[model samples]
Target: MAYSTTIRRRRRTRRIDRAGNPAAIGRWLLFVAGLVALMVVVGGITRLTESGLSIAYWKPVSGILPPLDAEAWQRTFAAYQATPEYRLVNRGMTLDEFKSIFWWEYVHRLLGRLIGLAYGFPLLVLWMRRRIPSGLKPRLLLIFLLGGAQGLLGWFMVKSGLVHEPQVSHYRLAAHLLLAILIFSLLLWTALDLLEPRHGSRQRRWRAMAMVLLLLVVVQIGLGALVAGLKAGYAFNTWPKMGEHWLPPELFALKPFWRNFFDNAIMVQFLHRLNAMLVAGWCLLIAVSTWRFEAPPRTIAAALALLLLIVGQIWLGIVTLVEGVPVAIAAAHQAGAVLVLALTLYFLHMNRRTAHHL
Candidate 1:
């Protein structure tokens, strides 16, 4: 009788360890992930529109309220005039034109603030009620810290343009974008970990492939950011070949040779194209391996879905480039990248969980 009682206690403990109020926590996480997606899309628009440097200040608290009166608007415009972008690029921009860019940056910053509040308040409530699983506390706290760092990193990127150049550094833009994607992926992975079932046999090879695919997707995103930063898409404006050549001649013409990878528009766009090919090839490998090994049904389905999304993403990217990276299509492509990353994380988390069960 005592042995049976101990067995029951252990089962109960395992159940508790799996999750504490998972339904509530998972829902919150999904909501935050959706918001992050919106932020990323809007951020892309802000960059494409060249509105990222309009505000000229990072007022985390007071900047919430946009210029209300005409006098206030003039003051805002005057501040922008002091920056190099105004003198070098937008010298003739009027107040109305200034507002057009101002709102995009404003919305981007507002969304960032909202995400912070949405995440923090609910987290506090859940923690007070003892609804968050103890094992998850540290992970959630780390995500919050990363979120804060992302905000500062964004300002750092903006500060670069404000000082001497009309454009932010491609490196800083890549860092900011990469960090945001990382936070979004982490939230998605944690939420799926909490909500999904934990019973299945693991495939070690498949697990390794999924992780590799995830890392490649992240690197591709960073490359895409660099392409956008350098406005590289507008230069080539062709697919399968960059302006009638398989490899553009001016790719490495920049001084110091290595500067071409980040600063040279031709080289940046070429690298992005090469990286996309690598990512697509990796996805194909994962799909074939999963099917050959006869992995779990969930794993197979995820692998197939990932393959489909990546194919579509590749198509979208080509179209976006062929058409000169139009705002609408480019934003959709950016959002698609996030979705691919989220799905990849889901696959990796599920694979690891299955291994743990085994």
Candidate 2:
């Protein structure tokens, strides 16, 4: 009886330990999501302040720390001066002004590094301790690696503007933004998986719609990035009309047809506006579908919240564009986008859960 009691106690201890494992993983996921959110805001500042190309060099290992002395600062500034941005845009910028932009990009990189450590060290510890399932280790490590790759891709994006071009490649900018959003979506989705139990029922239709909305949001964001890359927002400067008409003249004036969508400011901005309308329409549809159907309350709530957010985001976009992409409004517009992405992710996961149960 004594031995049996000891065995039972040990088993209970193991059970408790097992129970806490998921919560720890959940906490880490939440931390990563928060960090990604900060990265997005900082990224917006980098772009709005035109600070992205200030660093001029990518030192993945050594660049984590900003310059400490005047000599180091001069070297960094000298590199920036060599870039086309400095020659064409900020021809006579002082070192002090250069420092302002340098710090923003530096901080952006630093946050990324910290996020890696915060994710990786804990992940390794958990895996070694058998707290993380064997199956999850590979997927989680891929996420960690993607975060690292994002930094490299960022450098690649910056390198484009440092040459003949006055600004970064819109294509690279779109890819970078898409990658970041994908990382955020993956983290949030994984967190949902860990937080919730196996599904008892499923809603396939809503799930499909949720995913479609997500893809539309991502595409819209990519288009928005292209608009930013080209500084296209400055051209439109109005809501519901593009310089007096709903559609601009000769969207394919740039030639090859697709180049207009990717390269032309007027066409790119026009597409962004159109994409926003499509996203808002999809959100409204999802909201109505979720409300009318007898699915999970979370799904319904997420859809409704997303609908409201979509409306506000559209308004913010108009204000930002009409107001000439002012820093505050532009930043808010970007923040609103991330929020909408989060809500869509939430609803999609909920839909997945509902479907699994069914």
Candidate 3:
């Protein structure tokens, strides 16, 4: 009983103030969220450049430094040459070309390592110092585990391409991308919860609306990932319609009907297009609702930000597809999805009531 009372007193002593953040933990999480967003952008670059399979190996520790010498470069290139991607897709590619792709994938992996360090190092220090809030301890641990799992899943996705297929499985690709988004969302949400313990409006209706919009955005993001995995954007380059018709003649050309949704490039692109419309419509509805009800200033600001993001994301997607998925536009389009998701998360947290305030 005495020990319990002492623990309660300790918790009470570490109170939060509106002007300040929670012992740098919330800020640290925000910084980690930024790194995850960068990782997503770099992942897009790695895929677009056909560089994902260039590395051909996953050395969690030793791969930190790139090939340092001529002999090292040659050995690394030789290992890549043994892969199915090199043999089937990039056959006869020169050493200089191999180096170009190798660097993108290397940087991608390096960012992952850096993110892990960025999150883990601070968490360890804070934990040892007993600065972390008791309510957030288990949540942080879970986030760390998810980060480790994401690394393993990334390698699993890469392994698929190192075999017979020159490209990774679209299913694995979508799963990998969604998992990254999940981690990012979790980080962002936790940070918000810590930073604003007394935040959020009392409007439960707006909370539901925000949640629905967030789900729509997440689903649309998954569809975009599927489109990328299937290389669907390169085909459907028309705006307002799909190449002279609202529906293509071969929309469902695959034998099994469901396979068309996953394996058929045309169908995948169509789904992505349709989902984007749904997401945009939902965002508009929520933005207008926030104005109609005269929500708090911060709430309206978050909604307005989300509204603008959806519009910009729609334009980016169209330009990317119409321009035949140019590397720069395509990378921006992928990055834009993360930005939209981040803003949506902010909007959701504005109205969400959680039990984990410190």
Candidate 4:
């Protein structure tokens, strides 16, 4: 009887350990998401401070440390001066000024590298120990690869401006921003997968609709990056109206219609403005749909939070544009995008939970 009782107790302990493993994975995923958010803010600073083109090379392994001596500094500064961005835009900038922007971009890249390690190392150990379920291992590996691709895309975006444009190409900038959003979305999705809560009382269609709105908002943010890349915000300082008219008369001034959308500042800024309106409308609709659902209070609450974030992001965008996209305001605006994205992801996660519950 004693031996039988001991075996039963051991089995109970094992069941309990396995029961809540998903929540632990959820928490770790949340932590990685937060780290990526920090990387985004740092990246925004690098762009706003005009530091992205400072490094001039992608030395992923050995580029973490900044130059410490005069010789090292001269070599780095000379590399920057060789770039078109330095020769045309910031001609004759002193070493001290170069250092300022250099550190911003350097730190941004360093953090990105660290984040990759932080994610991969622990994930390997967890997998080895069989802590992660077989179903999740593949998904987690894909997330890591996506993160790696994002880092490469970042360098490619920066490289575009270093040749002749004196600024990164808007298309490349948009690609970079989209990649970042993609990484964040995937991370949040993986986190949701780990949390496998039972579906709540909400319909699956409602959840799918919310996910669509969330993706639209992410695409809008990519356009916003184009606006920033071309320094377009500095031109259209007025909100809701682009310099007295709802749309600029010279929208198609560029030679080809396609050129206007890709190369013309007026068109890029207009698209970003129009997208904001669409995002707001969709957010409100999602919030209303979620409100009418008979789901857990937290699920509905996440939807409401998402609505508020969208509203706040629009307001921040206006302020940043009006203020000439000052470094701090611009950084805040970028950070706000991440915040709204996170909340939207959180709502989608809850929606998935609701679906499972049913």
Candidate 5:
């Protein structure tokens, strides 16, 4: 017992001795993860307000500044006036009205630009200082590249709405959202790996359950993107019953049937609802198993967080649906998904190691 206690003390001492650069980098990644979440919230607002296509053009550099004077404002408005959205829907929108929508998209894009700089500049300094873990260097580079691809994807999604139709493609919207979530997940997982990293593998309990939950959450979130893209929430205002019955009658409305899952508005909303039930059930099972088994401190905390957040998310989704998808409520619903995913990632990371010691 005396020798074992001394070894534990030495291990703690060594841990303290090893905490400088990687720790700072971990904290930095957390900060970046936060910015990503904020951007998701703002993106929700932008979509809810229909401000995504306000700028009418993607200017990587010169577009940073909004219109400064009446002439510039008119020119910008003229540009928007050329789009299908202006001609078909917002024909008589004034300059001040234009500015209101413009700011949301502007801030959204501006935030994206700022995030790029925030990540890239600090990363360069870290590389120069040799602060990054050797194994993590490639992962960080891939994340940066993915970030760039995300920017391109955002514009691509926006461009679809600029063409003949006044609405963006639901498929493209789902892709964009999924990619953003992916980036956020990677940023978070990487940060956790650095901050409270495990030294070696242990017997992970309920590992399969956690993986399934994570996958279900991702699919459910994507289904949500479909709901938002198709504006399906507006189609059905009653829940626990999607209009009149527990099952939507139009689940296979499209000819191919599979297309109904993606393109049909009513069908999309139904699948999203169905998927939510699976996610909730699976989460409850995980929570129970964690309570019944011997789980680590962090894992237990993560499970509780998931339970609370998942319950809140279900309630929020119902409220959002019944309230006719109001901007504030709908945006909160989207943010709720992010929170649930964050906890799920923590749970998965925690389950990978068998130690209950920490």
Candidate 6:
């Protein structure tokens, strides 16, 4: 009887150990985050190539397989021809030209499907095995829901272009891009939180600063999305000044005054540049404050890393703008925004962990 009881206890211990495997969960989250990052880069390319409206319909399942034959390709192209994008902008485009644009949108949608599988399959398995921490289950589920919303939002943005106008509504475009960034940020933060072994001493002031910086990073990302949606970068094509003036004459020229922020290309581009400077300044403040306060080694390291990322991202943005938003440089700049946000969130998470312990 005693031997049997001891074996039962050991089995339960093993089950408990397996259920709370931090390394496995952390790695899974990181993998999902990577896919999200790739999706962002691919989405950037799709936007730059003007291929977003190529797919006239959104078939979550059937859409997986692209046009496999000439007939199907013709049908797909026909549907695209019905949309305003083709009618207004791509009029006179040939079948071959249509295929060129179609592939980018196809790959972008395909990546989204792949991300859903990569995230859902592992998540379901973990949940079934009771491996996910009870506290984390709801948060993980929220991320999954947010991912689904992003998919729907993508179609909504495309639909905008399909309707009356040849271009997508900048508002919907910004929403879609910001949602993607938010999802990425959450996944990364959750993974890092789980991976952290223990809490250190909290720096309340530093924590607050990190949180503020994280918010600023997100806002900057939204501004960038606006710039992309408006195709504003193509107009300025200069650094430091917009045609010999810090603020161009066309900036805020729109009626209602506020419309300029979202609808005015010159204003949108100028604001994006302005926000970049603000984010850089905030990052600098954090780095200097970290040194002044003599923050924990980990906090100090995160601050320095955040500063470095901000600098690199700013430089990339300048190059992308100066070069008229070339595909490669613009994509890198978009990815750099992801990296910057990731570091800022990581720093915030670290500080919060310490605060919780205190």
Taken over the whole model, the C-alpha lDDT of each candidate is 0.87, 0.83, 0.88, 0.81, 0.87, 0.88
lDDT string, candidate 4, 1-358, tens digits? 9999999999978855644488788778878988888988998898888888899998987787778899999999999999998888899899999999889988999899888988989888887776776667777888989888888888888888777877887778788877777777777777766666653434686678777877787778887888888788877898778998986798999996788887788898898888888988988887777677555677668778878888888998999988888899889889999888877776776665343310
Candidate 4 segments exceeding 4 Å error:
1-20, 199-201, 292-296, 353-358
Number of clashing residue pairs in every model? Answer: 0, 8, 0, 8, 0, 0
Q: How far is candidate 1 from the true structure (C-alpha RMSD, Å)?
A: 3.0
Better of 2 and 4 by lDDT: 2
User: 10-110 in candidate 6: lDDT tens per residue?
Assistant: 99898777667876788889889989999998999999989999999999999999999999999999999998888888899999999999999999999
For each candidate in turn, the TM-score is: 0.92, 0.91, 0.94, 0.89, 0.91, 0.93
- Candidate 5 stretches with Cα past 4 Å from truth are 1-20, 199-203, 353-358
Model 6 RMSD vs true structure: 2.7
Collision pairs in model 4? 198-356, 198-357, 199-354, 199-355, 199-356, 199-357, 199-358, 200-354
Predicted candidate 3 versus true structure: per-residue lDDT over 283-351, tens digit per residue: 888878889989888888888888888898899989998888899998999899999998888878878
Q: What is the lDDT of residue 339 in candidate 3?
A: 92
**Alpha-carbon RMSD, each predicted model:** 3.0, 3.0, 3.1, 3.2, 5.0, 2.7
Candidate 5, residues 1-358: lDDT per residue as tens digits?
9999999999976655543466678888888988899899999999999998898999988988888999999999999999999999999999899999999999999999999999999998877766666678888999899999999999999999999998998889999999999999989988888877653235355677889999999999999999999999998999788878777778776898678878899988888888898998998888878777866665666777898899899999999999988999999999999999999988887766543221
Error of 2 at 71 (Å): 2.3
Residue 39, candidate 4: Cα error in Å is 0.9
Please give the distance, in angstroms, between residue 180's alpha carbon in candidate 4 and its true position after superposition: 1.4
Give the alpha carbon lDDT tens digit for every residue of 253-342 in model 2.
987887897889999899999989999998888888877876678677778889999999999999998888899899999988999899
Evaluated at residue 343, the lDDT of candidate 2 is: 87
Ranking by lDDT: 3, 6, 1, 5, 2, 4
